[model samples]
Each structure stands twice: as C-alpha cells, then as structure tokens.
Target: MNFLRRVFEHGRFGFVLLLFVLMVSTLGWKIVDLHVFDHDFLQGQGDARSVRHIPIPAHRGVITDRNGEPLAVSTPVTAIWGNGRELQAVRDQWPVLAEALGQKPGRLSERLEQAANREFIYLARGLTPEHGQQVLDLNIPGVNALEEFRRFYPAGEVAAHVVGFTDIDDKGREGMELAFDQWLAGVPGERQVLKDRRGRVIKDVQVLSNAKPGGELELSIDLRLQYLAHRELRNSLLEFGAKAGSLVMIDVRTGEILAMVNQPVYNPNNRRVLQPGVTRNRAMIDVFEPGSTVKPFTIAAALATGKWRPESVVDTTPGWMRIGRYTIRDVSRGGQLDLTGILMKSSNIGISKIALDIGAEPLYSMMHSAGFGQSTGLGFPGERVGVLPNHRVWKEAEIAALGYGYGLSVTAVQLAHAFATLGNDGKSVPLSLIRRDRAQEGHQVMEAEIAHQVLRMLRAVVEEPGGGGSRAKVPGYHVGGKSGTAKKVSTSGGYTDDAYRSFFAGLAPLNNPRIAAVVVIDEPSKGGYYGGLVAAPVFGRVMAGALRLMNIAPDNLPVETKTAAVVPGKGGRS
Candidate 1:
C-alpha cells in the first residue's frame, strides 16, 4: 500500500492511465469515422470495384409468314468478353484462348493491347453455347460470357430482300426488319450484379426491371407462294442471263402482297457479300418505264370518255405513225382494228392514235387514278413513288408515249397494284405487308362497267390466238394479261437501243379474278428481251402455282359431261 501510494504520488500511474485512455479514445473515434463519416465513401469505392448494373438482354420479335411459318427468329447466343486490364495480366494464356476462339494469336494480342486500358471488352461475339462453354472451361483469367441473341433467317437469300437483316447487335438494317424495328425490338431490363476484380459476375443481386419481349409480326406474304415466285424468277433470271429481276404477287381481294422477290439477292444469314445493289428490294424501290402495260389504263380512259367502246374502231392502215421527232412503229401491219383487237396485237400506232385523240389530261387522269405516280402505302423503307409527269402542257409525242406505257415510270409493286385494282372491279385498296384480319374497304377508281370492259380487252391480249400475252395463259384458268418491253433510258439522255426492261402485268381467272401479279426483268442479255417471251412465261408459271396453292377453282376447266342414267325401273317401261 505504501509502494502504490508512492507510485500514484509520482504521477507515473496517472501518466500510464492517461496513455491507455488516449489509445482507447483514438480507436473509438476511428471506428465512428469509418462507420459514419466515411461509410458512404468506402461503400461507393467498393461498389465501383465489384458492384455493377448490367443489362438483361431482351429477345427480338419473331417474324412469321401469313401462314405462321417462321421467317426470321432470334436464337440465344453467348458472347465472350473480358476485363482488358485483367486480360493483360494473363497474356501468356492468350494463345490458348485465341485458338479456342478461332482467332489468330497475334491478332488477339494486338486487340488486347489496344484495349488494355478498358475495363470491359468484347473478346468473341455470337458464339454458340457449346463453343462459349468450352472457352469458359479453360478458366482463363478475365474471360467471361454474356447472354445475347443472334438473328437467324430461315428463308436465307430467298426472302432476304423481303425480310431484310439485322446487325450484330440484333438491330434491324433493311426490309421489313428495318421498317418495323420499333415493333419488333423489345425493351431490355436492368439488374444489379456483384462482380469480381476480373469483371466476372459473382452474383446477381436483384433485377431492377423486367424485360418486355418483342411482339410477333405476321406478314401478309404466303411462304409457299414466295418460294414459288422466288424459284420461278430465279430460273428466268438464269435462263435469260438477266442482270436483275423483280416479281410481285398480290391478293386482289385484300390487296395483300402474297410474294415479292428480287434477283441478285444476298443471304441475310451471310452478310459477307452484302452490297447495296445485291440487297436492293427492287420490286418496291426501283422504277422503270412500264411500256405497253399502261394501254389497259388508256383504254379505260377512253371508255371513261363515253365516246369509245370495246368494239369501237380505230383506223391504223399504216403500221407506223410519226409524232414529234420519233416514229412509233408496230411489229405487224396495223389494220382497222377495234380496241380489243388493238390490245390483242399490242399495236403501238393504234394505241398512239387513241391517246392523241383523247388528249393528255384524260390519259394522265386514268393512270393517276390507277395508283400510278404514288407510293403503295406499304410503309416500306426506301420505296419509290414512281414518276408520272403531270405536266400542264403535254407534248404530242409525250401523250402518245403515255398511251403506250412510257414517258412515265413505275415500280413492279405499283404495276401489280394497278392490275389488282382492275381485278377488284376498279377499286383501289391499300397494299399491306402485315396480315389483315379481313378485307379492307377500297374506293372505286373506275366505273364497274368500264372496268369490266377493260378486263375483257385484257383477256383478248392473253386468250386470243395471236395475242402478245398468249404465253401467259394458265392451263385451266382464264387469264387476262398485258405485256410491255420498254427501252432503258440512257445515262446521257436518249434511250438505249440494246438495253430493255421486259414487263408483264396481269390477273388470273378473269371471270372472278383472285390474284394479280407483275414480272419485270432488267437487261436480259440472252434469249429474248420481249415481255411476252421473257416475263409472260414467268408470270404464267408463278400465277399457276399461286392459284393452285390458294385453292382457287379454275375458271376455264372443261365443262363436265352429263352421264346418261337408266334406272333399274326403266325395265318396267313406266
């Protein structure tokens, strides 16, 4: 007790106690600072190193034909990525990694070097699950896989121009894919994730939002008919050695496009050979002078005047007629012919005389009313509204040219739409790429009687023995069609003599028209370039298959014979 009192009195015990108190206070203050004042900062730093909000990939919509056949689909795929900073540390393993990824070691190293400062970098994208799993099994540092979707086209190049294609990120780039991208692309979700230092997700903490999957799109196209058209058009292109071609088929009842195809197509699945010319949707985007196909509309124009009938005579004693500096000549002698006979012969002089007499405004009115010089309202990307010059003062030659389906331009779809209007009793219906629940209402563009008369005239062009469109006949169907071969306009100014655009536009089963189609072949280098020879045959085969596929009854089927029936009671002679 005396020693303890001595120590306390000397201040040594108090000094030791003060030192202990100071040490405890410093530790307590440090604990408070870490838990309170510096808590958010520390937590934020940790989160910056390990916590992440990653995107939960949303799948693109499925595109289907009218019959519910899948055309375009999105398949789940795995893409490999890495933390460039971490990957740089594992440079020795890059050769093995590069081999598994089917990449050159040198290239992989170079890519990694370029991205060494990045926290995240794509190593390999669009990998199959098995392939990605194999890479992950190696357990290479900094390597990770993310879920993604790759667009797959089942139709390949056959429907490439129609369905279009998507980019690496699954965004639409062309065709209906680009046209309805918003509707087809869904909203991606967000999720909180806990990641490691190497950028691999260790845990999925929580989903901030749910992914909304894209909606399904059902197009009006019939896959069967599309295949048929595609096959027939491709054959014709090969046969004629044509530079390019386009074919369009429409359901006249609903104005729904059954099939639309273009040549020089590219595979949406393989885009290595993608070029603007190869991927062009020519049926909707490109235009050419329709040539003589417009004669039906001119006849309709004449009929609308109330002065000309289907049987009205036009004197064309000479085979040629001079207008301005150009001379219009017929292939055969143009005798005195009624409108029907003139259409059958496809006489340029005869049609020209009718046009010159009717004047320009009337012909323009007819063509304009037939859905020419306008968009088809299909909402297609880059669709051209063909040029129909509505010049206030029309030259005499221009008037004649308009009568013969020249001096203006039209797309294959536009020409098909016009013929569909004639098949629908002169009502112009809106063209559709999407499937319609029912037939939409249309406005009458011509008198029903006048339209019927024009249909009969068109029938003469196909049914008559010497008709130009005789090759377009379906075996057991009464078809009405017109053929046109227009000279391609030269880049300098005048028309090119060697280059020609062949076209055939018509509807099948004239009695009750169900389908209307147009075929246009650009620059047929071999065989023949005439519309009847090059385009009409294609139209015939495609239309025949289309009619059969749709189960349309043949209007020209031979009449059934009545069998003589003798009842068993006839023996009684009642």
Candidate 2:
C-alpha cells in the first residue's frame, strides 16, 4: 500500500517508466536463455535437418577419328567428396579414415583437419566406379561418392598428337580437347539428397541432366596413310639415327593434309613421358630456313617478272660469286646452267642473279602472294606465323642467299603448301586438314600454265641423274622436287656449321600432279646430311606409299629400270 501511495505521489510518468523497465528485464532474461547456452546445439540440429549438395557429374563427350575410330571415350567412375563440417565433427578418427581410403595419415589428417569447419571438400577425384563402391561399402562418416565420367583414349599414341587428353576432373587441357572444350564437356544435371547424422545420403531426388552430344569432326587424314607414314617415318628415325624429323603429305589439287607425321611421337593416352621438345607439333610450330625447297618460289617469281624462262641460261662462273661480303656458290659451282639446269643443280649463283634483277620487292611480293609469311589458319595450337623479312631489310648478301632459300624461315606445312601452289599452277590456296568434298575447295591460287611449267622444272630435278633431288624419284611415277641444306642459326648469332635442316619439296605424276609434299629433318646426325641424301629418300618412300594408298595411277610405262622410266624425257624432264 505504501509503494502504491508513493507512486501516486510521484505522478503517472514515473510509474509508467518503472513498468517499462520491468517488461524489458523479463524479455532480456528469455533472450539469454535461448542464445549462449543452446547456440551450438541448435546449429547442429538445424544442419542435421538441412539439405546437402548432391553432386551430379556431367557426361563427357566422345572424341573420334575421321573414320569413327574412338580416340577418347568417357568411362563411368566415382569421385569422393566430404562434408568438411561433418568430418571435423568426428575429427578424432582422421587416421582410421585415412587408412581406409588408402591415404597416409599425415595427408588425411591435414585434409580433414583443415576442412573441419568447411561446408564442402573433395577427398579424391575420378576414382574408378569399382573403387568408389569399395570406399562407399566401408560406410565411413562424412565421406560421399558420386558416379562421374572418366576419359579414356584407346588409339593411344596414334592419336596422341591430335586429340589431347583431359584432367582427372574431366576438363579439357590440350590439343583438340582444349580447343573444343565447350562442345566436348556436356551439361551437368543436379539432384537433392537428404543425409543422416552418419553423413550417408538417405534419399535422392532424381534430376535428369541429359547430355548434349558433341558434333563429330571429320579430319582429312586417312588412317591407312597415317599408319603408313607413322611406320615409315618411325623406321627412318631409327635407321638413320637422326635427332628428329617431320613430314607433311598434302593433296596437290586440293591442299588437304593426308598425313602429318613426326618423330618422337607420344601416345595421347599415356602422356606421362611427353617433354616440351617431343610434344611440339614441329610441322606447324617450328620454323627453319627452307634450304633449296624455296627454289621453286624464286623460279616462279622470276618467271612471273618475265626475266627468265625454262630455257634461259646463266653462266654460273666458278659456281661462286662475291655479293657484298657474302660468297654465294652452288654445291657444284662454276657451270653454264640454264633455268632448268639451275633448278636441277640447285645453282645458288644462277638463282641469285635472277633475284638481283627481279629485286627484293617482286620476290617478296611473290612469296607473300604465295602465302609464305602468313598463318595457314590451321586451328593449330601454338602455331607460329613463319618469319619472312621485309623487302627493306634485305641486305646485299641476304638477297643472294634469300634467292636460294636462305635468309628466311618457314614451317614444314608452309613449304608443302607453297609447292602445292606451284603444282596448282602458280595459285597457292589455303590448306586444310579437315575433310572436304571436291566442290568445297573454293578457289585456285596458281595458273595452270605456271603450275605446269613449275612441275616441268621440278621433274628435271628428279629425272636428271645429277639433278639436286635425284634421290626423290620413284619408279613409274614422274616425280619432281628440290633439295635444300640450311645451316642452323645459333642463338648467339652467326650460323652453326654442323647443324643443318635438310629439306625436300616435290609432287608426283608431273603430267598431272595430285599430291605435293615436304620432308624436313632437324639436326639429322646421319653421316650424309644433304637433303638429297637424307630427306629425299624419305620423301620418295612417303610419296610411293602415299601414291599407292591414294590410288594414283602411274604415268610412266613399266620398265626394267623403274628409275629410268621416271627420269626426264626426250625433252629431258618436261
């Protein structure tokens, strides 16, 4: 009663303030009861009743050869993931869990210990479904598995350089795999899985994620040609004891790459042994001075400028000439060589004189027009745009050397296409490795007459016994080509006297050329190092097998001497 009387005396405002303080105290006590004491238990209960990630792996599409031979295929597999929070909840058993999963206790302890509070973590990726099931059968807490896709390559080494493999996570890493990653990786689906306290999923809500099939890519390569070239090139590498070599076989008429063979080839399936050197796609990635193979381009340029003809003769005195500070000489120097003989003998002085009169502009323009400095746009990974100096940079000696296939760098594929242009009648077109029908060839880059004349000059090279590329001739097929030996340029400057890039570029059935090719050897340690000795024979074997495989009929009549029949005629190589 006294308290009520004092409140009435103090007034209504003071009494109201007292009532508000009592109400706040009651609410604050309730809040304390629900928070500090019960916080951890409440969180645990909520998580135990909450949803978890049910990883639904996407399917990886297939990689196949042009003929439908499987290069890479997805095999069903299982990957293990863990609820880091749950694992940490039972952190004391890290060693036992590690032992059960075939992992070292140290490694396992680090992982679980680190992920103790994390919401998710991947324990292992791409385990075989069988192995995954074995793990699941162990029924350990916190660990879970999912059926995933694992990529496998059956053709292995045969397609290793073409179709690259993927990572353990099914992501494309290199080769066509990386180039077409979007198409190769199918869309993944998702599902909802309810888990119990043991971390085992109690139920799965099906979420179908149908995979979109990848588009099939057709290649221009014939497996038979690929196999033949592979076998022959491999054998040559072993027989010659050479460091490395590259061969590119192209269709003269269409510019299709039939077989791109390289030495030290690795299996795409098992790429563990691949080093940077062996894995380089030399035909597209590496460049070198083309040697004598560039002779045809020079001859074609001179002919285009109206300064020379097949019959034009140049007196190559002493077979050597001092142009500026450089001494230009033919291997067989000092001869009165005609245009045909010049190419047949690979006369450096003769070609240099022609380049001198034509000057650097016309020749460079011709080469540019021939697609020398440009990229082939092959969709090749790490492909380089071969180096071609500007006309303004042509020093005196450089001009002479450039005229005879020096002072320039080109890829094996580039040389093959340039020769193909001459085969196509002075019209060089873009070369493609993808299979295309006859009608899709689009345009022509060489004049038929010019192409025919170039073919005639090349024929002289093989038909004449003393011709530069005489070794490239095959029996019953009128073959034409040029030989080149280029001293490698050292990084410190100048040139290395011993290291050379031997090269050969030619076409078959000179009457109606259907295939053009280039064979290049880098640092061939073989005893005889001329292009004629080392590269031309490989070109011959490659062409012979290619001709037979491509079903190109022989032009020359069969005779006792296959070499005699293919040699230049009464016209002497026309």
Using lDDT, give the best candidate's number: 1
lDDT of each: 0.91, 0.78
Please write out the lDDT profile of model 2 over residues 144-246, one tens digit for every residue. 8878888888866665666667887788776677777787786776666677766677876465454454555566776677777777777776766778888
Instruction: Please report the TM-score between candidate 1 and the true structure.
Output: 0.92
lDDT string for model 1 (268-383, tens) is 88887677778889999998999989999999999898878888998877788788789989987859999998888888988899999889888998899888999888889899
Which regions of candidate 2 are displaced past 4 Å?
1-49, 52-55, 88-107, 110-114, 197-199, 439-444, 559-574
- What's model 2's TM-score? 0.85
TM-score winner: 1
